[model samples]
Target: MEKITLYYFLVNNKATLGLGENIKLLLEDAALEHEYVRLELDEAWNNKKVQLVKEGLYSGTLPYIEVGGKKFGRTVPIMRYISVKLGNKYHGANDEENQILDSAADIIGDWFESAKLAFNGSNEDKKKYVEVDTPRFLDIFERYLSAQEGPYILGEKISYSDFLIYHRLDDDMALDRLADYPNLTKFVQSFVERPNIKKHLASLSK
Candidate 1:
């Protein structure tokens, strides 16, 4: 029952969730209690709040967290830490299962680099990424899902990787691009419908 604090950037009255958002969604899904400290990126470098975040959390990054007096940075580690604290879900059931889930999660992290290229790179770079790199990554994920007995990733149980994958794909790529990947599309639809996730997402829009 220790307090959990998340320090992240806010833009236009909305928090930038990108990687940090999924952690918020996961905490909500698990019915965990936490607080958020939103910072503005433009002024964060010299701002007192952000400076405290860097010093207190030992991280020069947005999406820093403090829980039980210990600080953490990065998305996956934070998710894993909280999931472990909550117990018996989100993370895999056993060591081998956990490893598989971790691998999947790491793959999603790798995809984010490609997503950046597609989103922020020049026109030709974006086109090449979307037409070439994006589909290849999607195919890998689609194949993984198809191989599973899934309404969630790694089989029927929803793991942290599922949320990570969903956010990255939906937030970064055009949904129409998913037409050829029915299983991936279905996974997104089903994930968003989960009661807590649905509620959390609605709150983000506000």
Candidate 2:
């Protein structure tokens, strides 16, 4: 946990915003020592300083982490590294748990891509996503959540994947559409009520 610095962009895209905010929220909730350095368009994509020292980093990419004087890339991997730095509270307790963690993370990634198709794809693609694809994913999410014994997938102990799940649901404005999604509704309500997250949610409104 030596001098952790997260470099993220100032973008309007909710997905990007959610990833960066999720990192900050986790760190904030843990009271971890961290700093968020906002990277402008030039610094993120074409900075000479970043280029000169980018060789040893995982992807030499922005939306990355600089910790212990080293860089790590890719969203899920960086979150995993953060968990390790924080004594692995968000990590799985064993191999079986790790399998669940990885599987859940993969599902989150896949769901994002499917949602992206609705956002940026052709009209026909969007139509099918709304009428067919979205309902399908929502059903998948509902079943998985209902099968869990606690609010989170891994029982009461919240994992890193839960943050992404919360964001995807919130970003899609699914927070208000909860007539048939009781488990998901509980997830959203409980997530927003977490102390640090509740404060952040309030700030977003004002």
Candidate 3:
């Protein structure tokens, strides 16, 4: 089989990982062979390489993937495609389960989008969102996790949703704010401590 190729920007910052890093983690967890094509964000966009990628997907987007002679853009769809290809249980057990998983992922995506806005919005807007909108979403996640047999989002099996939630919360939210929700805090802790995940994170720092 052909190796999966991921195209993403190389950043100098050690504090954050790009969206492609999540895909790299997924590939590691799935024990799949892959290669990365790291590009300087500015140069890639100005050059023909990124233009070719955009033409392939018909979208001007970064963090693209080429696997099995096909192209995928955007994080969520790429994750779903790879999970299915690797036969990872993360895709869920059936269509209904997959739908449930997709719903959770979409909600998480929305939360992060709102978070970005909150970070850049006016002081009053930020305060309203952090004090009001943020907790509302956190409550939804907490309630869902509390009701489930977790450690994970769905149940006994660790799915992409678990990684999705963990990455966003760990990367985007302040640790102090996470204290109010013990389940979410624990969820992020457990996720980071997983053997493969732990190793992957350590490698990033180096």
Candidate with maximal lDDT: 1
lDDT of 2: 0.73
Write one digit per residue (lDDT tens) for candidate 3, span 1-206.
36889888775543345576667777767667788877776653677555665568766566778878887888888888777766655777888778878888899888878877887799997998878987888887887677566777776678888777777666555545777887777777777788888887888779
Compared with the true structure, model 2 gives a TM-score of 0.85
- Give Cα-based local distance difference scores for all models: 0.77, 0.73, 0.75
Compose the digit string of candidate 2's lDDT tens values, residues 1-206.
67678877776633236457667767765667888887665643666446735567645655677777677777788888889877888887888887887887898788778878778889998788777876676677777678677787676788887887777676566667667888877777777788877876776767
How far is each candidate from the true structure, as Cα RMSD in Å?
Answer: 2.4, 2.6, 2.6
lDDT, candidate 3, residue 110?
88
Instruction: State in Å the error of residue 112, model 1.
Output: 0.9
What lDDT would candidate 3 get against the real structure?
A: 0.75
Candidate 3's TM-score: 0.84
Best by TM-score: 1
- Candidate 1, number of clashes: 0
The Cα error of candidate 1 at residue 15, in Å, is 4.2
